[model samples]
Target: MNLTLKIWRQKNANDKGKMVDYKVNDISPDMSFLEMLDVLNEQLINKDEEPVAFDHDCREGICGMCSLYINGEAHGPDRGITTCQLHMRMFKDGDTIYIEPFRAKAFPVVKDLIVDRSSFDRIQHAGGFISVNTSGNTIDANAIPVNKHDADKAFEAATCIGCGACVATCKNSSAMLFVGAKVSQFALLPQGQIEATDRVLNMVKQMDEEGFGNCTNTGACEVECPKGISLENIARMNTEYLKASLKG
Candidate 1:
């Protein structure tokens, strides 16, 4: 298969960028999208040209490092899939593929197809963890029996891999869904309630300081999220945030 790729190229965050076209030939349909780029990069290296820079790790979709905006979608044309998990078979020969880094003020491009996502790390650090004693004694896993329904909901919310697809897909580039998921994961569980008020307030404040936009109920974030994080998580977060504000 052959493809014409129009990819965004930027040397640094301050540098002017544009879409540069390149042709790739003999790409296998079974080749993963990142593999196809590897082939293209190899050719560019052989010609002494700069290679395209993209992020990936574990290429198995667990790391959430393969963040990309392909052909106007968060992760190409595939739903519930990351760019590294996207296969070339999803396209046809002679197709034109457009690739861009995640477009957000918080995710400025560091180079071609690669954006600095440390903003997310900072937001998570603001309050995404539970404080538990690290004493050697192991407590029974069921020591505090939680309602089965709440446990299931917390587990579902915890599935979020912090991919930032929600921000990339949101018209406002809101991080509410992602933040909501994290908040919900702990808010519903007894283990997360001790510091719940502080956690919600701090995380939300950090999210705003990071320059992320507000959620307008567009629902695009949940749709593009590979983990299927639900809009319900956002609703849950609103309640948590309100309760936190009331108590303070």
Candidate 2:
């Protein structure tokens, strides 16, 4: 297959960025999206041109680092798939693909297709963890008898990989789904109960401080999320936030 890639290129954060055109020929449908980009970059290198800069790690789609906006979608046209998991077979020959970095105020473009996502780490650091004693053998694994339903829900919430696709797809650039997923993961588990209120409050506060917009219930975040984090997690966070506000 052959493709015309209109990729965003910026020398730096302050540099004016624009979509630059390039062509890739004889791409294998079996190649992963990142692999196709690799081929393109190799071609650019041989021609002595600066290659496109994008993020990728564990191309198996577990790392969630492969952030790209392909053809105006958060992770391309496919549903519930990350860029690393996307394949060339999804596109036809002679297709014109527009590639851009994950767009959001908090995720400013660093250069080309790369954006600084450290803001997500700052928000996670704010309250995405439980303060448990690291003493050896503090409690048995079976000490907490959590309901099966809650355990499953917590596990589902924990599947969130913090990819920021939710923000990119959301009209408001909301991180609520991501934040709610993290909060719900612990809130549903017994070990997370100790710092439940503080966890939710602090994370939500930090999310706001990060300049992430409000959740408008557009469902775009949930739909674009690679992990399929449910909107119910947002509801849970709201309930928790209400209770925390009332209790204080």
Candidate 3:
């Protein structure tokens, strides 16, 4: 298959970015998107041209590192998959692929297609954990029974990979879905009860500090999330925050 790629090329965050056009020919439909890019990069390297830079790791769709806006959609034309899992078969032989990095105020472009997503790390550090007394005796996880429904919901929310798709797909570039998933993961557990108040407060504070926009319930984030993270988690976080505010 022959395809035309219009990819964004930015030397750094300070540099003016522009879309560059290139053509890849005889591509196998079976090849993953990253593999096709690897072919393109190899071609450029052979010509002594600086290869295109894109973020990808563990192409298995677990790490959520492959964040690309392909043809105006987050993670290419596929549903429920990351950019790394996207294959050329999804496009036609002569398709023109528009590739760009995930755009958000919190996510600054680092190079061609890599954005600084460490803001997510900082938000996680703010309050994505539960405090446990590990000094002495350990409590068996099975000793305390949890409602099957709550556990399932928590597991669902925990599937969020922080890929920033929620932010990129939103017209507001909101991180509510990401932060909601993080909050719901712990909020449904018994161990998280201790700091529920501070957890929601600090995490939301950090989310705002990172410069992510506020969610206005457009539901675009839920639609584009690769893990199918629910918008219910955002509602849960809002309830938790409201309750915490009332307590104070």
Candidate 4:
């Protein structure tokens, strides 16, 4: 297949970016999207041209590092998959693909297809973890006897990969889905009960400080999330926050 790629290019965070067009030929349908980009980079390098800079680690889709806005969608036209998991077969021959970095105020563009998603790390640091007693007297997690339904729900929420797709897809650029998942993951478990009140409060505060917009329940975030993180998590988070506020 021969394809035209209109990709965003920027030298740095301060540089004004634009879409640059390039063509790739004979692309195999079996190639992953990143592999296709790799082929394009090889072509550029052979011509002494700078290659496009895109974020990617563990192309297996476990790592959410491969964030992108493709053809106006968070991760291309596919559903429930990251950019690296996208296959060339999803496109037709001679198709023109528009690829850009995930757009959000909190996710400023870095270069080319890369953006600063460290904002997510900061939010997580604010309260995503549990305070553990590491004094060699730790209780066995399995011994806690969690309810099966709650345990399943907690595991589901814990599958969030921290990809900015939720932010990018949201018209409000709200991170409610991601934060909700994080909060629900802990809120459902026994170990996380200790920090429940503080966890919701601190994380929500940090999310606001990062310049993320508020959620209006458009549900786009869950639709674009690769892990299919449920919107129900957001409701759970809101409940947690309200309860925490009352307790304080």
For each candidate, how many residue pairs have backbone atoms clashing (under 3 Å)? 0, 0, 0, 0
What would you estimate as the lDDT of candidate 2? 0.92
- Alpha-carbon local distance difference test for all models: 0.92, 0.92, 0.93, 0.96
Candidate with better lDDT, 3 vs 4: 4
True-vs-predicted CA distance for residue 223, candidate 3, Å: 1.3
Number of the predicted model whose lDDT against the real structure is largest: 4
Residue pairs that clash (backbone atoms under 3 angstroms), model 4: none
lDDT of 1 at 28: 98
TM-score of 1: 0.97
Candidate 4 error regions (>4 Å): none
Candidate 4 lDDT over residue span 20-57, tens digit each: 99999999999999999999999999999999999999
Q: Where does candidate 2 clash, by residue pair?
A: none
Candidate 2: regions farther than 4 A off:
none
Put down candidate 2 lDDT per residue, 1-248, tens digits, no spaces: 99999999999999999989999999999999999999999999999999999999998878889899999889898988899999999999999999999999989999899889888898789889987766884666478799999999999999999989999999998999999999999999989888888888888898888899999999998888999999999999999999988876
True lDDT of residue 116, candidate 1: 88
Candidate 3 lDDT for residue 53: 93
Model 4 vs. true fold: TM: 0.98
* 108: Cα error in model 1, Å: 1.4
